[model samples]
Target: MNILGLIVEYNPFHNGHLYHLTKSRQTTNATHTVAIMSGNFLQRGEPALFDKYTRAEIAIKNGVDLVIELPTMFACQSAEFFAHGAITTLNSLNCIDSICFGSEEGNVDILYTISKILVNEPDEFKASLRKYLDEGMLYPTARSLALFDYINKFNLLDISKEKLLSILNSSNNILGLEYMKCLLKLKSNIKPFTISRVSASYNSENIDSNICSATAIRKSLKDYNNLSLIKNVVPSPTYDILENKLINNFEPMFDDKYFDLIKSIVIRENNLLDKYFDVNEGIENKIYQNVFTSSTLNDLQLSVKSKRYTLTKIKRTLNNILLGITKEDMNIVKDITSIPYVRILAFNDKGREIIKAIKNNSDINIINKFSKTSFSMNDKVFKTLIDYDIKTSNMYNLVYYKNNQHLLKGPMDYYISPFYVKNMCFKK
Candidate 1:
């Protein structure tokens, strides 16, 4: 009954992901592992390298017992919201014992202390954060500076300022911190564990070793068609799935397709940009003007990015526009019910047991099927949230078709059943 939960994108499950998966089980003595992964879109405002079902199947083949879909509403959001959604889903499962994540620092104690500070923001801390925001710094940078300033001014913890800075500086550690923050905010009993990342640098495109970052793997796939270079870096199952897609002329989703879609949306609805989620502070005008001139996704992102908003932020906002996710949608989801439904993507036998346990104990609704009639008895929020997931899948499939006209696999979310893997390791 010792189930370990992980929140992941698995955007083409690589060697580094495998290492973390094995280490997580070993360290926690977990009998089962559950992964709540992003649907087609990712937090970085890009579509996954492969479809969600393929990624979920790979996760099950590797070692994970269960795979659940983190809805597109949260998947394509900022780090805090993404962490909040994943943690909330795992908590709703009512079966997970602990949640483990990879961090650059690999120190849960430091992360825990910082999480407390975030959850229990004192007056001085709030003032410092407000000061930084007034100074025109972006929220992420401003928050980091504010934390650094507050911790030193009040001697918050025993950790040094330099050490604290390093924790915030690392991307994985920042995510790990957010996970801890959410867990504490929810007052959940699930323990937190951090596994040191062994991959190449977070976003480094240079692949010199067997383990490389997902960013680098995607770059390699786009820049070179040679699958041999990454064979050693990804597990056998991952390699097979990716190779099959590539061989079938169904390449990874390129950003240009998404950018073109966004461009069309922005140009046609230029006056309605403010209605899109995260397209505030006059960013819509920048997007509208730049979409006409930019030829590539990178060009559009760079043109719209400024000190106030990072490139990733701009891309995430654009993703919201493409999906027609408005600020009102986010507010309703967040303020009313953060997680409305728990949806299964892929599972094995052990996962089935977990699902049964969840069904018996969980307070949230469970979704194993994706048809319109499936929501006939559900709440309006469930329909609203699930609709976003459906739209994301439809859009992802459209982009897939644009990339591979001949290898068209029709949208499977609505018609296909949750992927079930026969027990390959257990012989009866």
Candidate 2:
């Protein structure tokens, strides 16, 4: 059976996502489509609009056969680490034939070329990068300048600086390059495919087209309780779910809402800031000092932002602090070089077949629920990794308490079951 693998956030499934899903299945002509999706938190260093189980259920109801959770630790990281962890998980499945992702350029050839440069890191490019870094340029700007210099000097490809800049500026293209780099670095067998994004740009915050950016949809949802305009950009099924969620006051989790809790965590870890993952270059002190007076996540980020650190970077670091994901924890998992387990969020009948295939064909543990798992892993290591996921879920569930009955009592990790969507209907 040809199985297509996809990486998704689906913060709230929309028309753009639906198009990508439909095209992915058609392009691969695959029997099954499996998605590795972000859990509660997303790559953008924010909690998802809806919970993971709800999002996964929507995915399966639309087209995805199975949805597996990307560990929160990796999901809320930078592009490189996020791609590395996601690609690693997809590769671990051992049955996927291809991995399809959406890109602004949709040119796998160019993406692959960029990936080669990133993977190989030619001497001249590295020197240029170092020179720009020494000049105190932000990492992203410095890397872009370095690549521009090296590419032009060597005449690597028949491309222009402006075109390259456009490519780099496109967030989807950047992620597509990272995905390609991961596959090349790992020498994995799964083929990579790209689908071009249409209409709205990645960061666009207004819905002006049928295929609108998720950012736009989210912003609209928050500013206006009405879904009339949003209905244009998302599938009817997704729209219905979103409408219901809005009616119940279950949405738009602005990061600043957890400011008090995040501040407490940051202040508590002041002396031990070095322990937190991604709080490098003495950024811990900045966060520690800022946490004292910063009232909101936005305030903290603005107070801590600098030439070297973007707001997104600061937010991610703060998120790590909130989850208590230490550098030591990251190192422990990195040392093992493999995820301890894969958690299934939602699936259909086709997904049941895929699970059976996984059991018979792969060695990695598949967790439908905590109690149902029977895998032999070092107790300490297993707990360490799973703790981050549980904590992230509990934190996200806190935001959805109005709609989520299970979370009202306590954390919903154990009580939550793998959602099953049958006949395009969502089931808890």
Candidate 3:
């Protein structure tokens, strides 16, 4: 019963994901696989192309046995928090053998070394990091430079500064480092494995091959409004699900979809924007100032983006505001040692077995149904986390089903059940 865990945001399952899934299982020689995936919103603070259930179903159809929702509070956050939520959730399962991730630098040893330095945070590294921050460098930029500085100054490893910078600069490498960092912090038994990312880069915008980035796929869909344009890049099941959504006129959701709503909220909460998570250091003022002049979400984000605030951070802040997630809410959950519950999104026959394994081996709560009675209402932290998941799902559904207003009668999360696939056969 070797179970492999993966942290993912399979916004739309594609060929690259298929390769990683197959290779990861082969590398770990695992009997089953579980994925902790982002819900309605993604880390980049954009709405998913399709809803969570649809994406989860595609994951099952492709290869993964079970898909658990990475709670909204963590899904739409920075790399550290996102990795913390995902790594902690997998650890809580208490049955995972190893966790696998895809990265440009496929060497686990190098990633592990970087993670150790980050987790330990030596005095010299801290001093250098602070120096960079004080110099007005963006946090990510500062951190990367600081890492290079610390390693170069101490001659920690035999690696060159150029090689180290290259590793830190790659998005997947950075994320993989975060995963290892969390694993070390928890002292979890789950071993980490990495596979080299093939073909397109993480943010590549053009479809050059069958394994192009999800960004390229989404860009094609957004630009052409045609599913066939991405038919070659994604697995057949993914294409089918996407085509179905297109046929139903439930066009893929994007950040721009919420522009009007965001604008309205910014206006209504102008003075109150400081209450939202990530809306600190007078960023609320920039948002309020930009909302009136910006016609689209991208425009507003660009307007608000500065040396201190990256585009992704700005977007996350706006999303936090839209979702009504407060800094206080983040503060409450910040110290939570483990995820309060594991919410199943979709699963197959093997998934059921995994669930049973979790129940027998772990005390973590398993949420298959979204009813109020399933969780402890008395637990404020649990309530806060679960409420955000429910709120984000309902919000996504409201926008997704905008054309079919009749479907918005009640909260969709309560009515939706974790999708079940009878057969566990992986589709090639």
> What is the TM-score of each predicted model, taking all chains together?
0.93, 0.91, 0.95
Q: State which candidate, 1 or 3, has the greater lDDT.
A: 3
Residue 417 C-alpha lDDT in model 3: 90
Query: Model 2, 95-206: lDDT tens per residue?
Result: 8899889998888888887788888999999999999999998887888888888888988778887898899988889889988888888788889999898888888998
- Candidate 3 residue lDDT tens string, 344-400: 999999999999999999998898877744554678878899999988888788789
- Regions of model 1 farther than 4 Å from truth: 127-156, 336-338, 402-411, 426-428
Cα error, residue 244 of model 3, in Å, equals 1.5
Candidate ordering by TM-score (highest first): 3, 1, 2
Off by over 4 Å in 2: 123-142, 145-156, 335-337, 374-376, 379-381, 402-409, 423-428
Which is the winner by lDDT between candidate 2 and candidate 3? 3
Could you tell me the lDDT of residue 8 within candidate 1?
Answer: 95
Q: How many residue pairs clash in each candidate?
A: 0, 0, 0
**By lDDT, highest first, what's the ranking?**
3, 1, 2
Q: After superposition, how far is residue 252 of candidate 3 from its true place, in Å?
A: 0.5
lDDT of each: 0.84, 0.83, 0.90
Q: lDDT score of model 2?
A: 0.83
